[model samples]
Target: MTDFITRFAPSPTGPLHLGHAYSAILAHDMARAANGQFLLRIEDTDLQRSKPEWDALIRQDLTWLGLHWDGPVLRQSMQLTSYDTYLAQLAARDLLYPCSCSRADIRAALTAPQEGHPHEVYPGTCKQRLMSDRKPGDALRLHLDRALALLTDDFPRFVETGEAHKGTHQIDPSQAHTQIGDVVLSRKGEDIVAYFLASAIDDARQDITHVIRGEDLFDFTAIQVILLTLLNLPVPTYHHHRLIRDDHGKRLAKRDDARAIATYRAEGKTPADIRAMIGL
Candidate 1:
């Protein structure tokens, strides 16, 4: 068995901000402390927004910040075939269906107020959609109800090591259906795979024993666990760390160019300074 393995996955939709450094450093620190491996994944799934220069800068920033990941970095763009294979397996089990609902369509369809723990979930307007009826612009959504049933009543659960919400949390099937709802695996024809699907598959593929990321993503662990369970892959321990926010208390974003790692580097901030800035 592996001692400890975790990953730092960032989408290259934009620059690596302070938040990215914190998560990457934390994962790298934990992996090294355990005498284990830390992996890096460039989640370049959004073909339109993801840019080559940003991908290059991500590596440069991480290297400048002194975070070293083991093995070759996994680029999601090159793994489309693998994701498709997993999609095929899920479709074979009859757990996937085509959904044609748009954001506006779902909003109009929901008469009752939604729980929306993080955001609104799909109201299953396309729950009855058949693969045969799938049109050119239909997204492939997992039949969460059917998928949950395959897990045989023992709903997905995980151990959280983050300081904020550390505990053993299990998914309530009802909550997952109503709150989480159907997760997208693939979108609009075969052009893209969803973040939830790709990350779940990559985490398992890279043998990531622990997932160290920001606390904002803590709530979404359920979907990952569910996907891993359905794929018959081992689920990893999760550690969601605190977010590095700006003066306004807003979490850092790629648009926060002032807080980007490259910005700090160009400002002559040392690696130690970077550590101090994010309170590593």
Candidate 2:
């Protein structure tokens, strides 16, 4: 909480729900309490679903909640070239390989339980394949093994402030592979950059010192830490707060129109009512 700089980044694919409001309010209040900066980042990397109208709606929603940001909003769509530069660097170092595996192929490969937690770990079918020999429909994947190998004496670490996992934790190679497999750095064709890659880069680029988001993203943070280490970026302290859930204990989704902030606003629910509802 010392000179903290946090962000409330939301993808413009859908309406802002109660969970979104809690995260935004938490980040904004934390920054305010510490006399630091709070930022807004539009994670619209998924071109097909993201809409400019949705972006505007997100702004309106946050403003209604009285969570004003410190500066102009940072859009991920505008930083594709910057992301490409980082991807090129990884490719040059031979830390990335072309993956031609389709979703069905990946599913089938993951079906055969070899080791680990039997989760969907990439079977590394295309690890040995070179990018030069790959076809036009290939996607780029981070060679996690190679990336970890490069970090020799300089071990990657991150500070976690969440209730579930707290303290300084050093990222272990075996655990990284077991928990999160070789993640795709880029997609098959358009909007090649993956969420993990782009968001990590964006966080570092914006000088984010603290990442305040929902606890659901807690697992994926280790992967982002790995990417930040490889790219020589500043690793921020993460505060994964509790998620807003429904009566049945299900996380709120964009399709949950009943829990959407806009819907609540139309129903005459105040921002104070929102804070009380989310246990803020």
Candidate 3:
């Protein structure tokens, strides 16, 4: 059997909150219980929003939680060259196109009858457009149709772990073609690397066997699976756990300063208290 390798990838955009603690503990506990390896990945993909102080705080917070990773911490910000290599490969296959559409323009375009997937769907406005016509500020997007064709031409079926995914999950070529339209692989700001693309590449490079994250990102699994197929990378088993909500039952956000782990720690809340508070 393959050794289990799991990761707790947290973005260093803000201080670690209760939600972050829950995820870190869960991933660490799972790894410990199975004698598996627990890895820490700093997902500071958005360089503009990510801060050095926040990164330091993340290390401190996790250490306070008594969780230790097996390997040196991996930071996504340092892997731009790797992302560029993958981008070039996709572009060479004609599976990527430059998109000049702004967020407002996309929303306007989607105002009409929605034809494809629901969550953050990107209509194929620039899928077939010539690259020369795109402005310098345009974002790079993956041509879903081309990606699907490539996947279907190679591996026609994919099955995800039933234990982690609730049941065996298969990706039909036709469904992937329709549901996952063109998605943004990179944007203009800060050298053009986006979360979806960077994350997919990093996960493969890290040799992660399992991805345990919040359930809020469950819908995003489809797009990641598609990217893995296009890149010919092995897809990891995914476990989307329940989120830590606020007093109003809303999902915790970084802006919720009162719920920040630092605040909880300052209030003399023990790690055991944190585990109980989050029902770990």
Q: By lDDT, who's the top model here?
A: 2
Candidates 1 and 3 compared by TM-score, better number: 1
Q: How many residue pairs clash in each candidate?
A: 0, 0, 0
lDDT of 2 by residue, 10-114 (tens): 989889999899999999999999999999999887677789988999999999999899889999888777788888889889999988888544323321122
- Model 2, which residues run further than 4 Å from truth? 103-119
TM-score of 2: 0.92
lDDT of 2 at 10: 93
Cα RMSD for candidates in order: 3.9, 4.1, 4.4
| Residue 280 shift from truth in candidate 2, angstroms | 1.5
TM-score between candidate 3 and the true structure: 0.87
Per-candidate Cα lDDT values, in order, are: 0.81, 0.83, 0.75
Candidate 3 lDDT at 255 equals: 80
lDDT of 1 by residue, 1-280 (tens): 5679999898887899888899899999999999999899998776777799999999999999888888898998887767888988888998889877774443222221212325567777888878888888677888998888888768778999899989999977877877668877777544677878888888888888999988877777888899988889998899988988889887777887999888888988899998998898
